[model samples]
Target: MTAGSRHSVSVAGVVVDDQGRALLIQRRDNGHWEAPGGVLELDEDILTGLRREVEEETGLQVTPTALTGVYKNMPRGIVALVFRCRAEAGSLRESDESSAFRWVTAEEVAKLADEAFAIRVQDALAQHLTAPIRQHDGLRILG
Candidate 1:
């Protein structure tokens, strides 16, 4: 395949609390509210990258309990693996990647995040029998 045909992989975790709230981070670079995650390094294992990304952005050590969704940003050629995670340790704090953090209910997530990202968290919280596979253009989900 040509370089343009190559897709990058990213990992994200929707850190959920006991009350069923999910964590959202206001990204420092863009100020967009979304789940804590980033592109995976070439040598990194998926779960290790997920844990690193979540902790880097939200300052929380998380244990991924479920694979919630697989999303493709068609325009960007980015394929993201999203997981439902439980916070195992650490405290929430701001970092270079995130400006702020909030624990939001499922409804609040829809309002706070772009449609492309909001769906990821919703799928995680919904606890589907099979993970949803979806496509988007970065902001909106595709049909």
Candidate 2:
């Protein structure tokens, strides 16, 4: 593939509470509610990127427990690895990347996020032994 056609890898973490509610962030740039994540730095490993992204967006340090799902944005050439994470330290506070944050139930996640994003949180909550792979057009699922 050409340099311009290369795909970018991103990591997202779904921080689940004891009540099974997942943490969602309202992105400062887009105002869309979704899991906390961002593009991985060239030198950073997956686990480090996951922890950094979660902390940067939510001000909470997290330990990833399981790989939840993998999603590819076909139109944007972006592949995201979603993980099930548990909060290990820090408190919830708004960061530069996020305007607001909340712990939401599965039903609330569906209402707050688009199908492309909601599925990630739902899959994380389900905790299947094998992660699901999916494709989308950035906002909706695709075949």
> TM-score winner among the candidates?
1
Q: Write the per-residue lDDT of candidate 2 for residues 73-106, one digit (tens) a residue.
A: 9989999999999999999999889999889988
RMSD of 2: 0.8
- Report the lDDT tens digits of candidate 1 across residue range 1-143: 99989999999999999999999999999999999999999999999999999999988999999999999999999999999999999999999999998989889999999999999999999999999999999999999
lDDT of each: 0.96, 0.95
Q: How far is candidate 1 from the true structure (C-alpha RMSD, Å)?
A: 0.6
Model 2, runs deviating above 4 Å: none
lDDT for 21 in candidate 2 is: 94
Output the worst ten-in-a-row residue range by lDDT, candidate 1.
Answer: 97-106
Q: Point out the worst 10-residue segment of candidate 2 by lDDT.
A: 100-109
Clashing pairs in 1: none
